[model samples]
Every structure is written in C-alpha cells, then in structure tokens.
Target: MNPYSVRTLWISDLHLGNKDCKAGFLLDFLNKHDAETIILVGDIVDFYSMKSSHHWPESHSQVLSLLMQRAHNGTRLIYIPGNHDAVIRQYLKFNFGHVEVRASHIHETLTGKKIIAVHGDEFDSAVCHKRLTAIAGDVGYDLLLFLNRWWSRARQRMGFPYWSLASYIKSKVASANVAIQRFENAAIQYARRKGAHAIVCGHIHHPDMKVLGDELYLNDGDWIENCTALLEQHDGTIQLIRWTERCELLAESYAFASLQPDAVSEKKDEAA
Candidate 1:
C-alpha cells in the first residue's frame, strides 16, 4: 500500500511531556504519511507543564525517537520553539543532523507563495497585552481542555463522532472569539511585515485555514485535542486534515496516497 505522500507537513503543540499529548495518534499519522519536509511549528515539548506535573510515557519517547530517526534518514525537519519550550531559542540556527532549529522559517510553496512558519505566541503576547494575563488565560484554557477530554470520551461511548468541546466553548465565549480574531489579525500583519504571502502557525490549538484579503492563514492545530496537521501537496494545495475524524476511513495504507491536484477541476474541464 502506498503512503500519503506530501511535499511539506506542519505539526505543532505536541506538548510531549504533558499527559494530554496524543502521541499514539501522531505516530499513526507519521507512519501513514511521507513528507519531504516537516515543520514543527512549536510546543513540541511542554517544558512549562513538566515543571508542575511530569507525565512522559513510552509513546511520547517513541515519537521523539522516530522523528530523530526520520531526520537522520534524510527528511528535512525545522523546529521553531514556542513559549512552552522557549529555551530552545538559544539554539537558533543550530543543526542537529538534518534537523534545523530556528526562530522562524519562511516556506515557499510549489506555487511560489512564501509562508512564514511560527509558534504564534508573539501574536498572543501582543494581543493579550500582558504576560500575567496570558498566563491566567492559559490556566482557564487548560480547564477547558480537561473538560473537553471527559466530554469527548462520553460522547464516543454514546456513538457520537469526534468533536472538540474546547472548540465549541471557545466559539461560544465572546472573549475567546475576540482573542482568536486578534491573534489571526496579528499573524497576518506580521506576515505582511515579513514580506510573506501567508502564515502557518499553531498555538491556539484551533486548526483553521482561510484567505484573509491578500493573505492566507493556516494553523496546524495540536496533537492534544484536535490531532490535526497541515499538509502541502506536491501541486502546492494546502489541506488541514483532522486525523481523529478520518482515521477509520483511512485504515488502508494507501489511503489518500499522493494527495493529487483537484479532481473537481479535472471534472469541470471534461464537462466543458
């Protein structure tokens, strides 16, 4: 069975040392997909949470090992440290074999659009206006994620498909929605300042992609609650795929193989 081959794969908010990290799902995704380049947008390690409640299982370790092995095997890996693991910022420009650590990276899609890869905390800090306030907000966000886990489990037992309780709550809350909007706006502004046509980031754990005026915004989401990844096809099309929802439909190794260009466009041409 062929694998889902992609030109670039972006993933972030792994929070490897945290209990909520979905290492198993990430492993499954990595096993099923092949990418020429992998961008670890940020929070790959939850050093912040580790200080308070350490929880690193074998699965998490396996994920790290596999990524390093893949790097050694010639896959290009770029890591951008986020606030949670900002200690790596000191190592910016360093290379551990095929892996490169940088403050940020500008990725040029096959279609020639330049997109900056970042952790998105800069936008958060700018929008939140204060470090203390951002920390307080994080505490509340964690509570929502805790509740989201239990709610998801209960729903699955009752035969419901996967859903994000945290996302639902965020959408319902006025403040949360405002913060998200501000964050996205800030991201676009930053991209414009950097001369990029698009931005790919992950911090809010909200997987989304949209064209905002002349700019494109893409978030790879998180491994914890959403289990989503952003993919760039060989033809330069971007896809935001939530693995949890499609795992059943993609049990076959050849599922989504090649992720080719638009079939709808081909159909239209044929019709004409």
Candidate 2:
C-alpha cells in the first residue's frame, strides 16, 4: 500500500512509561501515516507511573525518538499536557526540538472552522476538585488495564482478534457512563466559551465525532487500549480510525463518512 498522508493527526493517552502501553502498535501506526501537523493531546507519557515504578522500556524511548524525528522532518508538533503527565505543564509555551508545548491551541481547519485543542483534564471534576477520589480511581484503572493485557494475550492465543476488556467494562458500568457524559458535556461547553466551532481532545479515552447543535466534539481515544486516532483530511473532513481494524477494513476498501455540518452525535466509541 502507498503511504497515507493527512492534514492533521490527533492522538493521546499513550501512557508510554506504563507496562500496559502498546508501544509496538503505536509505532506501526506512526510508520504507516504521515501528517502535516501532529497533536499530542495529553497523557502521552505516564509520569505518575514512571515516578512510582521507574519502568521506562526501550519501546517507550523509541516512541519518543520517532516523534522527535517527525518534528525534525518538518511536521508541526503540538504537545498539550494531561493530568497523568501534568508536570510538563510547567514548561508551557516552550519549544523543544520543533515541538511546541501549550495548554491549549486553536486550530483552523482548511474549511475555516476553528477547533480548540486541549487535553480535557481541566473539565474533569474528579481530577480537578476531588484529588483523593481521582487518585483512587487511577489506581483502579491501572489494575483494570493490567488485567486487560492478560486477557488480550489469552485471546490472541485463541486466535481471536484484539478486543478491549477495559473498554467493555466501562461501557457496561453505570457510573463510568455517567462520568463520560459529564466529561463530554463539559468539553463542549468549554469549547463554546472559547468561541471555537469544535473541540478535539483526549482524556476520556472515548473516540467520538459528534455534532452538538452547531459545534463538534471529537476525541482521539488512546494508544493504551483502543489504538485509535482522529485524522483531519486535507478538505477539513475528520475521521476516527481504529488501527487494529485497519487491515481488515482496508481489504474491504473502506472509506469513512466525511464530517457533516448537520450530523448529530456520530461516534466511533472506543473501549475506555
């Protein structure tokens, strides 16, 4: 297949320093696609996990190196710090090896639509106001991801395709659904406040492309679980793609529907 090129690519929740991070898959995805602009929406590195366990593997290092190489190759790179790697927030506005760090950015699409790019943690009440609860939740989430890794390996042994155990649990859990709804509402409202036509973010780990009234809400999902991303075409159309399904879908000559102005709540829901 020929190399695929895009106008913009948004990805996040890599949690690179964590044991469960799927760095090999991410590296493959990056190698397959090239973009004019790349947005690291947040939680690209699991600093909290690294601080606790100091588990930085060669795979994680390779991921970082590849990103820097891309930047050096003239791709405009933007890094927005998320809660897990929030320490980088201190160096906001600094440029490191062609990558610009920022709290948020306003991206103008080819069609003149203004999209607000942020990590989306600021709108998460648990992360913002309930510190203890948030930390507890993070611990639980880590355990879930650990289990998911084992579960996925077992499935692979059985010759089954990749599936997200954590994502399935999140969808079935009532509280998780409520939290996701709240996060989505908060993100849309924040975009409105910023006077942006749309908002692209990653934190909830739910990939979606929805039109709420007149504005759009997009999430790039995560590398740790869903292995998904949000891509903007040269014509300003956006697509939420799952890397795990790419091979099968490409065999069928799949083409995603373009973003429509009047469309309401279209989503490519990923496992949490």
Candidate 1 lDDT score relative to the true structure? 0.78
Off by over 4 Å in 1: 129-137, 158-160, 245-272
lDDT of 1 by residue, 1-272 (tens): 45578899999999999877878778878877878999999999999889998698999999999888889988899999998899999999999777899999999888677889999988866777553233223677789779988988899899987777877777677766667778888999999999988899898877787767678778888988888888777867776677763542111111122323232211111101
- Per-candidate Cα lDDT values, in order, are 0.78, 0.78
Note the residue pairs that clash in candidate 1. none
Clashing pairs in 2: 167-271, 167-272
Reference-based TM-score, model 1: 0.86
Top TM-score hit: 2
Model 2: which ten-residue window has the lowest total lDDT? 247-256
